[model samples]
Target chain A: MAEATTRERILGAADRLFGSHGFRGTSLRALTREAGVNLAAVHYHFGSKHELLVATLSRHIDAINAARIAQLDALEAAHPNGDIPPLDLLNALVRPAFAFRHASPENAEVVQRLSALLHSEPLEIVHPLMEGLFSRVMQRFAAALERALPDLEPEEVYLRIQITIGAMVSALAGRHPPDLADAPGLDEEERIDHLVHFLAAGFSAKPLNGADS
Target chain B: MAEATTRERILGAADRLFGSHGFRGTSLRALTREAGVNLAAVHYHFGSKHELLVATLSRHIDAINAARIAQLDALEAAHPNGDIPPLDLLNALVRPAFAFRHASPENAEVVQRLSALLHSEPLEIVHPLMEGLFSRVMQRFAAALERALPDLEPEEVYLRIQITIGAMVSALAGRHPPDLADAPGLDEEERIDHLVHFLAAGFSAKPLNGADS
Candidate 1:
């Protein structure tokens, strides 16, 4: 392995601190100590704490999105002229995200924690970054889902997509699934597969009719 | 019509500040100033910032849970013979929580924002409080669900329940659900009904077999 750059080191420190201490709890002085760099270096490299946070999140998101789009491309290529299953599309979207935990548990934890911030922060703070990173990818997946499940209404498809994304976030953030005390545990692969299965089944369910109305 | 008590005013101010600025971002001095109370009064009333937060959250949770159980009881009473559909049960579970937003937009925003903390905070901080508030209610709902869907495995039921809860939290926190720029918006009632429909379909879907394995 090659030596890590100062930027990488600082980002790594920020990732862990922000994950553990939260954005507000983690201070510049503490982050500098953790990064083994002075405040001057931080200011020089990232300009401010907010910039550093955005950088750290953007780094992970780039990798995650690249993998998702690659998986989508591969699946589409493999199934040329045929619609890919909605589950496959969702799996393609979430597999790389879930893989982060396996690839780097510590960093993944930080990302997972920061995801809470993404949800809670003011729209202006998160909206631009989220749209820049995810809007196109979600649109692609939504379109693919519509093609695969032709009977479902466009609005219901959007609703399912939203709920499915919520499930994905829950899994990525390690929030709700797989933690039941009496429930049998699933390994990481199984958990991903299970989530994909649950969401696919959900997305494929028959459209709600006038009975609900 | 009556004047609000000092404690209630402090809690109300804390709720908004904490929701907007987050737990660590909002300071005691700021809280006191916003509450229109002196520091000594804050110290006397709440003892500490943590206690005040707990009180604020507890107040909402207590009311929400009571409404939930009341709905469940009412549904069960009307049905009498366990004929209620899974969707009704889910409606009972999520309706009251969602109603908070429409009931009082300001306080609801605080609760919704605070929910992000419930998700992102360390398990040690959240686990006890969550268990204290939700464990029994969830258990009752789980058992009710088991009766409604007999063929599902205990673990699978548990899994669905967890995912459903994740969806509910997302909706309640007002996070990823309502902000789609192009998606036609639903009123609060419709949103709740739609969520119930989606979750019911998802939960009612047949259990996944070994094909995923």
Candidate 2:
């Protein structure tokens, strides 16, 4: 087995701890011990626990954003002239993250749980990092969605985008909230397809007021 | 001025600390100090920090659920025979919460943020309490949704219910994700109306496969 390096060890341990215990719940001392590193090594390497968090999140953000951008690029190439269907555009937003089915289940769970927290929580330390990572990517998708739905006011489009992200983040969090009925189990691909279809209809919904008409 | 009772004080302090710093981040010692009570008082009133969290959440849950049930009952009466429109059903889920607009903004913000976290984040100490509080309410809404959309499978109804909730929780959390275009501002009423329309369309969306058709 290839030995993990100190930085990699720290990041892995931090990610798991943060994902499970949350940012403030996981202390630096506990993180150091979990990483099998000296306390001083933590500060020497990452400056502080907050910096370590930003660093850990940055690593995943790079991977997720890269995958999303790559998906968008491929879709654009195939469609040409940006005549993308709205559902196809929504799929690009979610497909990369849902691609975790190919990864080890344990690793995928931790990443998704962590991704859900980072997106949903209001911690100051985490927000700027998440925004920085996602802003450009969100803009690209927004433009694509606008082209696909020319009738949607920019504001309406924005609300639907936010709602779409909310649903995606909730699914990634993996709680499977207690249901009144037997919740159907969709395999990973079907789950993604269901989410894409649901969100496409939501995005295509007409405004409440007659302003647009 | 009415002096706060020991129980009320403890609940208030815990709510703020938990809302601002999260459940794991807030400690018993800090909570006691902030509440202007001693260590013994915390245990005297709430047993432990975990119990304290349950209590704090319960206070809000009681109010919010009461409001929801009341709204649901009123809608059912007006539409009789469960012929309620899906948007009105969706409204019952959100209208009560959005009524916070008439209250103090700070109080509303904290409660909404807390609600979002409790629903989204998984913690052993927190889940059962939340589930106990919400399960019956969810079942009622699910039944109402089923009646409104007879074509939707029970499983599809359940999934859309989850998605509608995801959207509401995300909005309450209020991160205002970075966007390509300037997001429009809507008053509380307008926001709730927008959400109802968007989610109603989502719930009414056709299933992607022939299984449902």
What's the CA error at residue A201 for candidate 2, in Å? 0.6
Please list the residue runs of candidate 2 whose C-alpha ends up more than 4 Å from where it truly belongs after superposition.
Answer: A2-4, A15-30, A113-126, A182-185, A210-213, B16-30, B115-126, B179-181, B210-213
Shift in Å, residue A3, candidate 2: 3.2
Index of the highest-DockQ prediction: 2
lDDT by residue for model 2 (A1-213), tens: 237888888888887787777665778889889988888887888998767876876676578778889989988999898789887778778877767534534445445545444533456755666578788999888888888888877766777788788788776654435545556565556666777778878888876664444
Q: How many clashing pairs in candidate 1? A: 0
lDDT of 2: 0.72
Kindly give the stretch of ten consecutive residues in candidate 2 chain A with the minimal lDDT sum.
A101-110
| Residue-by-residue lDDT tens digits, candidate 1, A103-183 | 887777666765566656665677677777677777777777788889877777777777887777776765463245566
DockQ of 2: 0.46
Against the true structure, candidate 2 reaches a TM-score of 0.88
lDDT of 2 by residue, B50-148 (tens): 577767766776788898999899988998877898877888887776675345454554565454445334556445665687888999888888898
Give the alpha-carbon lDDT of every model. Answer: 0.75, 0.72
